[model samples]
Target: MEISTKVQIVTKTTTYHPPLAISSFPSVPLITPFARPANCGGIYARDPGDILVIDEQPESSSCYPPGFATDESSFFSPGLACPSGYWSACMESTGVNTITTVTCCPIYRSDVSLSCVDPATLAGVWKSQFCTFIPARSVPVPVTRSSNGRTSTTTSTLVNPGGINAFGIRMVYQSSDVVTASSSSSSSSPSSSTAANLGPDSAGGSGLSTGGTIAIAVVIPVAVIAAIIGFFLLRKSRRARAAQPAALPAQIEENPHKPSPYYDYKPIFAAHQYHGGELPTNQASAELPASSESPVELPAEAQRHEMR
Candidate 1:
């Protein structure tokens, strides 16, 4: 009996659909008395040699483990602490499950992780419990889904359950760092170019403003000093002129001489000399005194009588 059995192959097919928008996911509270999972989406696994580092708590503290030192230095070595804007989520093994021992240390991923990362490139998936500080009520994380060879990405927020508003403590996955960095660089290129173009103008403007201010400061003082000196010199010149003595007018003397009435006075002197030549009887009459007064002149009648 040769019986041939027909063989059939069945393959499952899936239809691709984009992930729902990040806004669609309702807000969910974060789990508290927070415990670290054994595996977070198959990305991170707790190693046996891994040590849980936690912030030191005081005896009176209620949020953290007791008996730990109150200072943050007790948790890790220098430079191992988380950087600013980040907080640590230290985990410890409880024989059955891993739990968070402390969650308030400021440390980086390499400080807590036992595994080593490539220093040359920050590409690939890096899983850690450390989170960025979230001042808001919730923390947002990106989530991706792949269906029928199609992939999509969205974000979901983790809410605080303890009502004590603080940063969220959860596993965080960072993937495709290179792609993110490239996108950021491309977006920032235009702004950087514009700033570069405006740099020279801004520098020139500042230099011109400084030079103008210096010139004003120097010129104003020099002008003021010159004016003051000029004022002083002018005042001194006026004072000198006022102190000098004034000149007086010259005095004139009166003339004592008068014009003679006779046009020719030679005859009078000749006749007087002739009378004297006739041998005047009196010697005193012939000689005249040397006085400033003119000689006495006889009247016409007296002259007629003398002629007679």
Candidate 2:
């Protein structure tokens, strides 16, 4: 049986990576060696494409696939060429001038295994196997090109400082042809959709918002209920006060009858009555009674009647 494999090479500009401590390791020409105490074989400090023979096997060189470049390190500035599915990490010690290369391979089954080329040398700084490098996110921008391969314009904007976080990114793909990219206001760094979905920059402070909404929801009903109760109580008090009776006037109680009795009226009525001596024959000679105003004297019986 014969084995076949396809190799691809890619390189990306270095963004940020820690520098390699050359003082800790022995120095060699063209190889920045690091002293790793755990490994049996010494690690070689070489560029991304430098070859190294591993455990009785032939040496392998650094490689990358499509959508990637092979020359730049991650420490370089923005707009530098990089490959999809891979991100550049610059060494803090190297100060953006050095590059560390990584290679990856996929297997469908667990029985098949792939290993890193510099396992003994990269014991601390790198692992012994080529594993999948998953990033948190990716922000891609589009550039318009003419028929002659000249860039006419930039149709989409790119946001920077956008990428996967600790959560890791699964994949990045365009949902539509008319999709537009958003660039960061401060710089050319690409911003991620997560920033937009999480309310303008990935700030997860929703507790304040929820608290405000809940407070409003709770207080409005209580205020309405209090207002209704107060209205009903006020109306009931007014109705109770209006239902009471009115009091009687003083003039009606003081005088019970239409007219009052007088002193001289009784005497006049007695004088008009007939007496026994007055029955004599000459009725035409009878005289009319004088006015009380002239001080006429009253009989004893008339006086008793007036007193009563």
Candidate 3:
């Protein structure tokens, strides 16, 4: 990779101290060139080990190494943690401040811009968007350098971006990354087999994937709805059955202890002789002895009676 070291008039309000003037003197060693992250308000003179935050993208006009970026440049926050390294200034910066990295793009005027705010208000900086704070992930990569025939590998950190929520503003890409990747691969390899491998495979695979995803999305919801409906229907049927009145078997009347109305009364009458009140109608013609007369007889004839 080629690096540009020309000290152009990158900014109107920037200054630089002699690089080696104070290095030899232990009492006054030259300050190392470093930058603060753009979103971290602004940078100030501090110890190299001092922790700081990089909040925004560096300006394009400022000299910057390739592949380094801050929160403002990335559509998402790079997972890089704060207080690790210097962040770049936005392109709107009037001059290059040695304390921060420079942006690689033009100053975003109407669409977006960077400004200085208190550290406590840093979270509020992105209030225009839903994001309250940036979550960054940093990984170290090997950077090999040869100094006067001595080659050494040093670590250069890279940040991986994180996820966003559904409420975030939609990001639209003017062009697809697949096109650039395919073109770059084809140009570098210069092989017929490689070109064929990269051809319509992606399109076909993406289509199939989309179809499968759609099927799953549609089927899962339908199945869940059906199951819910079935459960409710079963519950309703059970409840209706439970609430219904139960039936009982027919009944027959029985009076085993009661006397019958058709019973004969002769058996009670024959047990004891009844006089006047119980006399039979035929007995009324007969005469009975009186107190005055001892015996009263009735004869068949007067003569017959005297002979006897």
Candidate closest to the true structure, highest TM-score: 3
Q: Write the per-residue lDDT of candidate 1 for residues 8-27, one digit (tens) a residue.
A: 99965432112111111122
Error of 2 at 269 (Å): 25
Residue range 1-308, candidate 3, lDDT tens digits: 99879766753332223211111112211122223234333211112222112222234413222233333333311111111121112212124331122121212122122222222333433332222111255544333444566756455453434211111111111111223323343333211101011111221111222123445799999999999999999999998997664321111125533433344324445645666776665455767866886787987676653554
Order of models, best lDDT first: 1, 3, 2
> Over 4 Å off in model 3, which ranges?
1-142, 146-151, 156-209, 248-308
Candidate 1 all-Cα RMSD: 29.4
Per-residue alpha-carbon lDDT of candidate 2 for residues 54-90, written as tens digits (9 for 90 to 100): 1111123222221222221211121111122222221
**Pairs that clash in candidate 1:** 81-107, 82-106, 82-107, 82-108
Q: How well does each candidate superpose onto the true structure, as a TM-score?
A: 0.15, 0.19, 0.21
Alpha-carbon local distance difference test for all models: 0.30, 0.28, 0.29
Residue 112, model 1, lDDT: 24
By TM-score, highest first, what's the ranking?
A: 3, 2, 1
RMSD (CA, Å), candidate 3 to true, equals: 23.8
TM-score: model 3 vs. ground truth: 0.21
